[model samples]
Target: MSRIGKKPVELPSGVEATVSGQTIEVKGPKGTRSFKATDDVTFSVENNAITVTPRGKSKRARQQWGMSRSMVENLVTGVTTGFKKELEINGVGYRATMQGDKVLKLALGYSHDVNFEVPEGVTVTAPKQTEIIVEGIDQQLVGQVAANIREWRAPEPYKGKGIKYKGEYIFRKEGKKK
Candidate 1:
């Protein structure tokens, strides 16, 4: 038996969930999110809780059973408290600034500033010159946005000069002997 699958997801106050066909939708004060399960697993809603059960004892069904339940739980969390990702910039003259809520201007020791356009359903903010915060209801989207920004200048082991996720550790390499 799958431990995660056996546990039902409880809907907190001010939250509602509905299961239709193979899809489950959760609505809360933040927003509404949904997840579609595979045929191997089935979803049911009862008594303010969502349950995911495997169609059969097959390996695939058991796998989907646990994954589908986690997905539904993520949907509930996404629509309630939302998700966030923080990025830190390190290097001489590297900085970030938010131009309203639409654009994020970045200077990573480049000749020209990088103008990152904010996508729909996500908000990017720069609380400090070297700190950036990405917020959104969708966890995947928020993480993707933060990754894309970090890609512009990934931290280098030599000098650690680049953008990286907050609290990320970069292994430093010793310089060549003179």
Candidate 2:
């Protein structure tokens, strides 16, 4: 009954997948990733395509059907094309720079600079003072790192000054009447 679950995930050339028990592992040019699904769903790989099927008609089974399918797709995509998150810095003094190979130095109007450590398995780069690029084979990790950076100085409404995701819109508000 799940539309998304019904569609099989097609594996691109040079990408491989293996389903064992409740765990599915996908390997590709970029890297390898694995996901373990609940017992409510089953995974099957055939003809370079992965299909997820619910074991019963229960609500939990149906829910796992779509969730498992999407997880498999993400693993495949993560290993192949990887993932990227872009962040933009606002405000006059707000900017970011790579301190060295593993640290990011951010100036966001704080009395002192904010030092953000880059975690393993992900790459953080600052192409420009106003731009930050987060890239990795794991989609979730890439997004989490970007979010952590944005948390330092979330965009405000008045001047829209702060760190924000690229293309994000800030709803502005007028100042209080005198």
Identify the candidate with maximal TM-score: 2
Candidate 1 residues lying further than 4 Å off, grouped into runs, are none
Model 1 Cα lDDT, one tens digit per residue, 1-178:
9999999999899999987899888999999988888899988889989889999899999999999998888888888899999999999999999998899999998899999999999989998999999998898999999999999999999999999999999999999998
TM-score of each: 0.96, 0.98
What lDDT does the true structure give each of the candidates? 0.92, 0.95
Report the alpha-carbon TM-score of model 2 versus the true structure.
0.98
Mark the regions of model 2 whose C-alpha exceeds 4 Å error after superposition. Answer: none
Worst 10 residues of 2 by lDDT: 93-102
How far is 158's C-alpha from truth in model 2 (Å)?
A: 0.2
TM-score of predicted structure 1: 0.96
* Residue 13 error, candidate 1, Å: 0.4
